[model samples]
Target: MSSHVKLRKERGTIAECETQVKEIRSQMAEQLKSLDLHVEMRVQLLQDLSEFFRRKAEIETEYSRGLEKLAERFSSRIRNSKEPQHSRKEQDLLSSVSCWHLILNHTRQESREHAVLSDTYSNSMVVRLCHITEDTGRLSKKSKDIGLQMQEQLLKVTSELQTAMKTYNQYHTDSMNAEGKLKEVEKLEERHMGKSADPGLGQSGVDAKQQRSSTLKKMERLKEKRQAKFLENKLKCTKARNDYLLNLAAANAAMNKYYLQDVCSLIECCDLGFHLSLGVTLRLYLSAQSRVQQSQQEAVGVLEGAVQGLDPPGDQKKILEMNHTAFCLPFRFEYQPHEGDQVCVVSAEAQVRNELVTRFQQLQSRLSSVSLETEEVNKTMKATLKALLDSFSFEDFSSSDSLQTSQSAESVKSSGSDPPGNKPNIAKRRANQQETESFYFTKVKEYLSGCSLISKLQAKHDLLKEAIEKAEGIDSDPSRLQCSNRSLRVRKQRPCSQYNHKLFTGDLQQFVESSGQLIPLVVESCIRFINLHGLHHEGIFRVPGSQSEVNEIRNAFERGEDPLTDLTDHNIDSVAGVLKLYFRGLEKPLFPQEKFQELVECVQIENKLERACHIKKVVGCFPQAVLIIMRFLFAFLNHLSQYSDENMMDSHNLAVCFGPTLVAVPLDQDAVSVQPRVNEVVKTIIMFHEKIFPGARELEGPLYEKCMTEEEEYW
Candidate 1:
């Protein structure tokens, strides 16, 4: 019984201990709950961060793609364009095609860098962040599971302890009740034993005694049963108390372990690891960004270097060097007037006289105006200089101004109210000097401009005066008239003067009759040689031959030598130049001046077939010799135009080269003003040679056979 009582007393202390442990379990569970919430928030944050990086990477990739496309589009345009990339006048930085190409290249490089950055963000930064989020979530779930399990374990032990305590209390109450019933039964029996025996009524007393004995037996039996019951209950109470105490100790130990080690470990793993991993992931992201920025900086540096390296002059020089042949100067118009026309002769002389007089009067007027302007500028410059000089003391203004000006500057410095080192006075003097110098320079610039203008006018005046004197001399000289008539008399007299060479500048009919061929030998030989060797030559007639070589070939032809027979020793350009020079030196152009307007008007017809017919009719009006040569030359030109890709001389280019030479205009007409029409006529002739000259024979076989037959007939 005493053990049972002591057990019950210890049970209350154990329950108190369990209650304290339960409080610890609650604290540990709350801590774990808070930790789980923090981990969840952190995971969400990391997920958001990963998504942000992913979006940024996507944007960067898209931007990079756009930049690449922009670069490629411009690059393709530059590559495919036929026009020159740079203009001759655009001689500044960034004007070269190379600079533009470099800029495109830089853009492409930048795109590549951006693409790399995108890749880094996607593959390195974003991926790392996602991995961190995954790991943090995984670890947080694991920690939360462990924490819940620990709390459940503690709570389960605590529930078992409570049930054990309840069983112990119930057993203890039954044992105490059984003990009280036994004590009550024993007190009743003692009272019965203490009662005296009364023999008053023998029979009643006997019956009473028997009843009291039976009662005593029953009471004793009940007392014995109660005592046994009390012992059993006390044993059960002790066992229950022991179980409750054991469970209480277990719960307490579990709670202590959870709060002390398990909970701390869970918090450490979840909270510290989460923070550390997050920081590492963020650092990795920053590193990736830094690498991207570094790469961007490198790209920018390279772009800046390319920009700094731009050299417009060097690029222009390189372009010129590469395309020098294509830059050959075009042919100039050579004036070739027609002969044997009295009306043309009178009109030419009158035109020359009027032109010379008009030019002389204009030059005289310009020279006077320039001279007066120059005088005014000189006077203004002198007045400005004199005014500047009079501000200082000088004995001789012309020679001593510089010295006196220096002295005056020193004197002003010494006489100033401020000290010698006064900065304000110095600045004021500098400003005044700058103003004075600016005024002087302005006057000097005006004077120099006036001088340049006067000098140019004087040169024009001199040239005009010389032209007037020469024109007057020609008008007064009888020799000029003889020279003018020399071409007409050349057929009868056959003058051999240098100016009247029989083979060159001679009558085309005379040459044909003399050579006993339909075409002159010079024209035939030049055309045959060019057809054999120079047809595919670049720039053919557009690029002129050396003057000395051309003159030598011309002299040989004029001297009646067949210089073109062995053209292996001659340049193709010189041979072509000889042909052009022969036509330009002709006393009459292939197209006569009298029919020039009619030919031009025919070319103006809007319809192509009608224009060709009209031009053919007008061309047929020429002498047979003219018609045959025109047919031969145009046929050859049409052949040359077929190789226009190689020679760079199509019908238009060839016509520009030969228009002024093959066609003649009246002296009263400006050759420049009439050149476009002439070029159009020549181009039309070349393009429509077969249609214009319908019966023209093949240049190789039939033409040579016709030439042979004609030569035989002439012989």
Candidate 2:
């Protein structure tokens, strides 16, 4: 029973203890709550204090207004009093009583509120203190964190500063060493002994070397050209020497066979076989005297033969009649003065006239294939006229001549008139004839005048003037006479003014003949010329068709034969030859300036070329304008081709010297105008190129490609 009770008591005690602990914990919670409650009460007190202060400020303002009103009322009363007997103390006492009541009441309110305010301020002060303590802990933590970060940054900056210090020290040492070295080098350079290179010496040496090379090259070229020229000259000299020897032998042979006497005798021969092929021109008049002697001798011989045969054959009378008929036959066939035979020797001799005629043609073929001019040859015909003259002069001396017949008539009457027809034979015939009457060659002398030398020379000049006037014109100047197919120019005997209104005119052949056709006329003119001048006879004379065949043809013309038709059919030609001689061009002009001289020479060369072309064109044209135009076209084209070739040569030279850029080529439009000048420049370049490299040709294809690749420039 005791134990049970004891356990109950213990349990009760334990329960009490446990209750106390719970209450204690509750009490602690209440204490914490009371602390929170104190903070809340403090906050509420602060709020009430602020409210009370605001209300107190308002109460003070009202109290001040009441005091102002009260003072104002008292001052007004005092000032308005009539006697002003109130004591200053009494007024002061009344004003003080009112203030005492207001002060006591204000003091009571303030006392009442001062406790609440004091408590509120005390609580706020305690809370502020606790906040300050918490803030101090927070600032301490921030300071620790900031101090650690700053220390790390400062260590990094210290490392960088150490590197910069090391670099600055090294730079200082280097600067000091460099300054010392600069001073030492300056001293060494000032004491140097070696010489510096000269500026111009190397250039002079190069020029000297170039000059030597050029001289050596020139010597080589000169040697080669000399060899070539020597060989060429030697060949020409050898050919000239052989030609000279051959000509000498031929000339000697010709000289040995010449004889003047045989020529005279041969002229009288009847044989026509002795042709003139020995390459000597025959003088046509050389056979005239021999011919006259032969004819006279033949006549005398015939007379002698007839006399010797005087027995008189069966047909002597008939033969005499035949001889008389034969003598008159010449007169019956005699050529008249017009259209008989006339041919110009000048036109025949022209070179251009020989297109179909070979240059090697015989002289006789060239001159005598044609006859002499008709009017002159017909009127003066030598053989026929001579025959007439001879017959007229000698007939008077013949046995049956008229002069002898008169003598016979007188004698016959004196012999007592013969029986009607009773005439003696030869003896009686002689007895009846009287002495011969005189008739001499004095008749021939009356028909002739002037010496023979003057006459022949006059005839030749007359013939020349006639020919010149007839074939070309009367122009005294050769240059003025240049035209095609012009006929002979024949002038009036006297200038037109001398003939009044009648102009003298005739055909070319007749005009020349009007001067004179008599042999005596020609002979007399020749005689006058001979007396005037002391020229050798052979030196100034030229007779046409001097060969035998030509003479026979001339004799045939005297007997009334027409010759022009035969001549025109057999041998004639037309020619167009330009005169090449120019006196002015031959005397080349001189110029003092070398450049001017060169330019003049160049111009002259060009002019000569053009003139040559013109001359060739004129010759080629002959008698046709179309032919002249064609020739001009071809000639001008040839000149253009030559100009083009020169252009190419210049281009090649330019290409070699100035690279391809400066080649002597002109652009499309510029080419037309500057071609001539460009050609000149190119010509100059080519000359220089040849000077640089003789016998040189253009650069090869690969070389050309390389050169042109440098850069092409258009001029």
lDDT to native, each model: 0.60, 0.29
Candidate 2: RMSD over Cα atoms? 78.4
Model 1 lDDT per residue over 1-715, tens place? 8657755665665566466545655555556556666667777887787788789889987987898899989868766767665752243245575687788777776666566556555655565566557656765665566556656665665577667666756666676667778888889878876652444367988788888788878878888988888888766655554444444444444444444444444554354233334444444444444444665776556654554454434543443354333222212211111111111111113335575467557767776776777787676556555444332221110111111112222332232212333334334433543454455555554554455445434544554455456657654321121223322111111222232336677777666656655666677667766776677776688656778988887887777665655434568888899899888878778888889998888767878778888898888778877777777778878888889876667998788789988888788975544667788889889899888874734222224222221112111
Model 2 weakest lDDT span, ten residues long: 574-583
Give the TM-score comparing model 1 with the true structure, all chains together: 0.32
lDDT tens string, model 2, 317-338? 3333443422111111111111
Worst 10 residues of 1 by lDDT: 394-403
Which ranges in model 1 have alpha carbons more than 4 Å from their true place? 1-36, 62-109, 134-145, 196-218, 267-280, 294-715
Candidate 2 runs further than 4 Å off = 1-219, 231-262, 265-303, 306-394, 401-715
What local lDDT does model 1 show for residue 149? 60
